[model samples]
Target: MINFNRFFSSLPLLLATLAVQYDEGKTESNAERLLKFGNSLLAQGQLAEALTQFNSAVDNDPKNYMAYYKRATVYLALGKSKAALPDLKMTMKLKPDFTSAFIHHGNILLKIGKMDEAAKDYQEALRQDPNNQEAKTNFESIPALKEHIIDAGQFVKENRLTEAVDYYSRVVMYMPWNVTFRALRAEVYMKEGSYYKAIDDYKSITKLKPDSMAEYLQMSKLHYALGDLEDALSDVRECLKLDQDHKQCLPHYKKLKKLDKQYSQAQEFINGGRYEEAIQKYTKTLDTEPDVPLYKMRSKAKICHCYRKLHKTVEAFKICNEVLEHDEENVDVLLDRGETYLIDEMYDKAIEDFRKADEIENTQRTEEALNRAQKLHKQSLKRDYYKILGVKRNARKKEILKAYRKLAQQWHPDKHEEGPAKDKASKMFMDIAAAKEVLSDPDKRQMFDQGEDPLDPEEQQKRQQWGQPFGGGFNPFGSGGGFKFHFP
Candidate 1:
């Protein structure tokens, strides 16, 4: 009205006039300072950095309504809805009439999967400003969502995990940020034995609700099942940090930490070549954490390795046998026992173990062990009849028969049932029968004892045609028993 626009038309003239009164050193209002910096960072999508600014503003001026509101929004932007709730509550406390703050809080509650709390927040927003279309829409949608959730729960109660999983998966698709939906799906996955997928969902829930000690504890369990010990340790540690008295977490954390320490000590002993101490420590750890299957198997394998290093081949074989009884597919134990057997010149047994390990998983190490064991086992067959029967070179006929009888009963194919063990038993039984045939024949036994393979077809036939019954002139298998062979 007074031609003010015409008076201030010159940009340079207006700036010069303001420079005379402007004080660069004046203290800025806390709300203004933080809000300005927060908005700048928020616009750049630097959510964590923006959160620092907004949070500072709220801390400095707790009663500032906009400070609480902005801080909550920043928290939500960071996908940390659990952190947003307190700020949202403060915003509500300071300014009950703020419809947008109500909407923001409702959305945050929905993100964290708190559906009923979300409904309440939306209802409050609508009460203050009935024209809030966002509030009405959210409120109207809740009942239908609740219906679907109830339907999912019913299927779960009926033990129909597959259907329940499908319903929850769909809900999660619509609300990917919802920890509740993911939690239900994770439970179903675990019930279905989809452990890896269960691990993923549990891990996501930990991120969605970082303060959820229960979720972290569950994640640690899932990781442990998958043989991820370090990840389990890390997750359980996080769970304890959130809630040290967490009922399931505290005991597991203590047990794992202790077990981890003991395992490390055993490894140290092994590295220092103290095989006996390492074996004892490994046995102790196994006894302490018997329920942890992965750890138990690993400890058993370690003990077997220690036995091998100490040249206690029989003890090593015994420990490995026990581990395989519980976990037949444990490749590490299989390889350990196989290597030990090969070095001990029990070639047939070595070949059996290496071949079984290769069948389970064709790794380079298993493949190499199998090839080497097979090559050596064939060569050992004709030369080491007494060794094959696990008897002394100068053993008497009665001793040979006793050893053969013991081995035969232990390695009978029928005794082994099916699978690799049965196959191995069948093959080893053939070797055992060959050993008994050659050792029991005085002609063949003398030839074998004199460092010849009487079991070799050419040699056995020549000896029989010549009727030469060795230096003792003893008919090894009582004449009639000479050629009659019984498989072990």
Candidate 2:
């Protein structure tokens, strides 16, 4: 009554079940069965099932460290590191020389960024079983820690402070004793705006190693940023003592000394209510450091303050003028000079300086030296063109023209009867012609009034032609006459 095809399919399952039961009953251990099942499941890529079977084997034979190790391997294959870690740890605890378990633990740590711990585990595994290929291979494989340190350096060079800090932290974790690495990381921290973090790192560096000039300098810079000038000065002195010619220390030392002296002198003068004396000392301080633009500006300012205190308007004006000579666009100098002029009842000069100062780009201290002579020229002042021609200023137009003609005729080099006077006469004739043209034209006269030179080359040529003597009575205006006189 059985369906033959169905029966055959069921028959194989039944036989397999019977055989497993027979094997279990024949004094063959459950541990062996669990081990076999685990192997079979593992071969089929059923990691979770294999893990269960191996775990069962371990439970059945707690003394069998191999079962625990195999179970851990399955757990690892399943990507269950938490489960795998504890099991591997236990395997190693059971078999203290379990190199494979230690290596696996290190690998898991590496995956999670616990590089230092991972490295320690790997090193311990290597010590326990130097010839264990898996341990040896893994120990070498955990990323080159030194390379990470170098990567931190590269980040610093590229001005990537945040990235450098991260890489440096990694290096420090693996190499806590590396004082140089700690110091370098601190520098990156400073650049990244974490000054407190930087200080901490610097302190760590000093603690881990002997004191050095570099550490002192770093501390000084931090103190300077924090406005603890006394502490900064102390560190700077220490740095200088260690390396007297250190270029970095020299600038700070000079600056602090100058500031200290200025402060003391200023206080003394100020307490006595001698503002003029205080200003003088400040000015002297500035002169000692001329290359410092700030010093120049401060000195100039102090000079003005001194003059104000002494109520010496003339001296104040002179000082402002000197300031202008040095800085042609100093707004303070310009304003001060303008005020000085106003006090002296020179309104026009004051206005000129004020206008020039307004045109300058405003800054700390600049000069505004107005051309006083040019500014004094009246707008309506007419140029005496006739006088330029050696005629009376009020001479009639006809008389002016006549005077110019006479002068041109007499000085024409082409008609010069003699020597060195010929060159001089040519120049004089050119001048006479130019003056006549400017006087004759109303527009040119106006231009001359505005201080512009107005001379037409054509007028000079025409005068020269007219002035030339007739050679053998030949007229240049008429053709076919004796050789024409060509004025040079």
Tens digits of per-residue lDDT for model 2, 433-467: 65766666666665543334444344335545778
Report lDDT (Cα) of residue 405, candidate 1: 85
RMSD of each: 15.6, 22.4
**Best TM-score among the predictions, by candidate number:** 1
Best by lDDT: 1
How many backbone overlaps does candidate 2 show?
A: 6
Clashes of each: 1, 6
Candidate 2: misplaced stretches above 4 Å?
Answer: 1-122, 125-148, 169-177, 186-204, 218-229, 240-255, 287-488
lDDT of 1 by residue, 11-101 (tens): 5434532443353225667566666667766886778777877878777887998887788787767666777788778878888888887
Per-prediction TM-score to the true structure, in the order listed:
0.57, 0.32
